[model samples]
Target: MAENPVKIEKKKKKKGLSYLWIFLIGVPIGVILAVLDVDMGFLDVYSLSDFVAIFILFYVGVFLTINLHELGHLLFGKLLGYQFLMFRAGIFSIQKENGKLRFSIIKNVGYGGLCAMIPDEDATMKEYAVYSLGGIIMNLLTGGLFLYLSAFMEPGSIWKMAAILTGGASILLGIVNGFPFFSMNQPTDGMMFFSILRNSPMAERFYESSLLTKKLSSGIRPRDLDLLKDFENIGDMHDLTKAFYLYFQEMDKGNRDSAEEYLLDVEKNLHKVPPYSLPAYYYELLFFALLSGNLEKAKVYHEKAGKILMKDQDINGLRVKAYYAYIMEKDAEKARTLAQKGLAMRDHYPFKGQALYEEELLKELLQKIETERQGQ
Candidate 1:
């Protein structure tokens, strides 16, 4: 009943964390104590100013840990041909200059350093890992470099402390990413590790890719609409063709109004999708209309969908006859002519064996139509 509804409610991502990083608050409070105890320190021009300096330092420390962790991922990705997209290190945004993204190194009391990374998708899978391992390797190496430099440097105190903080942060990022946990998706932990014990790191990747492809090819099941609603809250168009067919299936079962709404939405949302997906989408639409007894509307939609299909999309004689005879109400001679032409194309294409019922029904209907015309 509604005019052209668009069901573009792509699924959204959720925060899977148990809680906010509130447990880290203690580290900042502790740092305030350390800064306050320093005798004759430049941090305090006054007593209140001393507290402010420590608090500021505390905030800076926490900020650094998060950034460094993300940075590990970011730099690793780029050095390995990954293009960095965005970083979410919390306190500060990293700036990119001349193909190099900058970093902010801050040492914290209790927590480790933080960093962010964004990777480009253009590189091969092997190249992707080179980026993935960058953060962990760099942090470990930097900490060691600092230890050696401390022997020759006068500020052994600052470099030593920096190494301790940086080292911890680096190890934390590496372990967390390499842990082989369900949540981690980094190449080393997620894709690469699975490749190891299973002896096929590309196994999960291949399976996921295959599943998603098959899902699109088969189209969405009618019962899957409730599940698909959440998908719209996300980006969109990962499964438009299947979802649209599912909606059409809903219409097929006598829910005309709901089907119409879904079909329109799917059609509009498909504007951004590939043109290759259109033929199947249109076939489903025409099928739904025929089942719903909307012959006239089916004819209109059929033409729209039909104009987009090449002769290769379908080679089914029954479908061609049914489309012409039932949808367009064309004469039997013309309908049979088109059906025979379609059947000729089927010489190289077999009947799939699954459409046995539809094939029989189509033959019977064509014979009946021919008989009726003869009697007249």
Candidate 2:
């Protein structure tokens, strides 16, 4: 089916409200700053070099703050008996694959940094809370320390300026991340912490999802995993994690109708899906659209996800591109080459189950392409 007009209008209205919310937040802060007559003397720069140095220092501070926040999550997660699956700073990532650490550069999709850790099978809410709050605590402590040390340094000096910038960045990071808000559709540390404290269904779903991720990372296929057996209890079928797990489970079990239903539901709420996962989501929609002979809808999805499909190095991204090449563009050789590239990365991809699935899909595409060519 084509995209729903009413759903599109609702999505537009939601986006408008998001912008309105930002404006509302900014207006109060601006009014307060103006009313307080905030001093602007510190920003005075006599030379271009000075301006450049200040800019560089500011970015350095931001970089350091982001890393520290992620590091905080790592440390706390480890303390809570959670195992690290991946750590990402900007577009660079270190992932655990087959019990080995592998470093790679990835396409950045809005996230500044992330620390992905899976809790133990018997993990409790207290542990989850601590793990969630770890980053905020680190940020607050470091921010305070930097600000204090800066006060001891000579005003306007490079060292003092650097300290001030870093300290300010750290404090802002703490405040922003500690507040319950969504950053690019992913919950903040503070959000997660509070949710866990409240013992919300979302928190439980998140915990279950983490366990599911751990299993996937351990080379277990979705069909073999029992972590999501109670997925219906999540109370929100539209929840991205729940929908994704259900889709994977049904797909792995060869229930195409059930899988497509989940994907279509996800399509209706694409705004809730994280940017990093958009390519995969769109890929699934596009793949199913093609299989169901909905060429127009398939083309629309392909176009919508074109940028990511062309540039994304992930196995799923490659698989979609290959599928589109053969099915839509009718470029058999291009499809085979793209599929082969995805197959080559299967061993090193972070999620073993996903990698294996992509490998199988690619192989299937390759076989289809060869059969079609032979018939021609």
Candidate 3:
């Protein structure tokens, strides 16, 4: 088993202190106002009684919103040559390794699934564009459905109110996820990108892909197909294979600057991409830093890798960080500190649950560092 990646699980703070306050915060205020003949008191009681209606509205809104968004991502991704791994919601239960994609569903009342697309790292911008679009399309469709449903629902009744809330939610979900934020050039935005190219160089590439994809295909021969033996890794199966292949080319050509520049772009798209494939793109930067014999750059890359690994709370990442501290940073003391921390962390690793490999490496690295320090 691999080590878990989460670093610290912070305790959740109590909301409004306690559940007993649920009544104090709600009932008393209503009683005081009702005694005063205030309509607010009656409305509060009425709303509380309508919890079932509100709950249903919220649930349907969240589910349909997330589901439609996910479908939007899937459809666009597929259209752009990305292989779909899973459609589960909320935090992406879909897992992929090498070329195999697995789907898993996770659910809870009033919570929507976090649909994910774990495509190959080598997938082109086109595939990414579609994957992003899939979510937007889903949201748009849901919003439209809700809008349509509102017509049949009575004007101010519970069903009508639910329809209005859900429809509005769907529209907002589609629009928000479509907008580019953080690093991800959201699927909806990508659709917009496809629409209004402006005068950027990316526009030309888009035009080429749009025109070429219509007629261009590898048309692999039987012999060529034999070379591509892994049906699972086939282009149609996972786009990361292509992304990986291109990453290598970018690395081989020593496009270190270009590689670093592209790395951020990929990270933003990482949300739509898989976790495993993400590091491969980062590896391109790691390779660049290593090849240049720039210890500082290497150290930076190692720390970046550690952060990624830390998300899984894997002890191995700590071990890797330790090795970087010792060898690259020439800080044996800090290395020792990190080593012990990582070893302790291994106790809870999800995979293997042991730091045998990292421990061995740490020992070897510590010895070498000590030897070098002693020689000085």
Candidate 4:
């Protein structure tokens, strides 16, 4: 399938920083407060200890607010017959697998919290909108409640300050997430809500991807599932969701040439890619480059993705590192070690089908490394 000519949207650039309004407004006010000796009647901090306490409480409140936002999605999603797949806050995660709940610690960069749920097969657009906007609604409701409480509390009290700070944080979170924009390369709740409401093509792609992910989690391999037939003629190949599915579809079907073409296309139009998805994209490109013995291209992609590769503990990240160690660094022992470690993680990986595929890749890399060593 041939992609249409590139016509990028300039509005995406403007949308990138729309969520920074809180920081933009707060910084000037903070500077003004520091320049003046004015005692803000209700929010005055008297001692260094009080300031320290407020700071600590404010961070705690922010952490709690993140969890509350995710909880809102959970509660509202449940109301609409959506089944919870996972809930994650910071490094702690709880996921449902084989009808059982399991807790673990996992690293998910570029996100503060995540609430993943699968909608019912017969879910309507209204249900999706409600689920998507649930977190924002919770943030606003909690923010308002906290702000009201702070208004009634004693002036200059630590509790009052805590309430005010928490309220501000919650409101900020709500407003930032409620405004239609992309964060970490993924659309925000407001963006999803509006897209679903309008029944945009993006929304259709998003829902389709979610259904595909659910199938993956249920143990369906990419090679076994059919690709979206209509997506073959998609004009905007730069659309991440479309690119993602097509790339995987080709790769899983053992069409390396076609898969690499998709990767190279994404490389050329990277500005359209989400920031959070960059590392994974780079890793895949690096993998293909190494597999095809393109040392220079491998070097470029490895350099671009190096920071995340060094620290990302995901199964695929580990597999890529193992591949890189063998192909680029010529470290057979290190490659074997990383590949073994990745194999050990297969049982714990969230998506069983992907985990199984990664396991195969790691084993293949290990075998190749051994073959080369024996030849030497």
Name the top TM-score candidate. 2
**Tens digits of per-residue lDDT for model 2, 239-327:** 67777777888888788898888777777777666655676678788988888889999999888777656765667778888888888
- CA lDDT of each candidate? 0.47, 0.77, 0.51, 0.77
Per-residue lDDT tens digits of candidate 1, residues 1-376? 6543332222111122323223333465468668887554532343565455545644554355445555666666666644343354443334332234544332221223333233333334454445445655655555455446546644324433444445454445455556454331223344454454465634444233323333322333333323244345213343454455446455435466776777766766655453333555666566657656878767766676653332332344346435556546756766666555444443333222213323433565567667878898
Best of the two (2, 3) by TM-score: 2
Structural similarity to truth (TM-score) of each candidate: 0.33, 0.73, 0.41, 0.71
Candidate 1's displacement at residue 169, Å, is: 3.1
Cα deviation of 121, candidate 2, in Å: 5.5
Once fitted onto the true fold, the runs of candidate 1 whose alpha carbons sit more than 4 angstroms away are 1-62, 91-122, 146-163, 184-203, 206-376
Error of 4 at 159 (Å): 3.9
In order of listing, the candidates' clash counts read 39, 0, 32, 0
Better of 3 and 4 by lDDT: 4
The alpha-carbon lDDT assigned to residue 137 of candidate 3 equals: 72
- Which pairs clash inside model 4? none
Q: Is candidate 1 or candidate 3 better by lDDT?
A: 3
What does candidate 2 score on TM? 0.73
Mind giving the per-residue lDDT tens digits that candidate 3 earns over 1-376? 7542321111121242245346644576578668887753423543655768777877867776777676666667666555443455653456442234544443331235444343443554445455556666777777888889889886556676677668767776666555543222122355445544344443343333322222212221111211121233322212333333334334334455654544444433433443433453554455445445767767666665554444432455566566656656668888777777766665444232123434555576667767888998
Per-prediction CA RMSD (Å):
16.7, 5.1, 14.7, 6.8
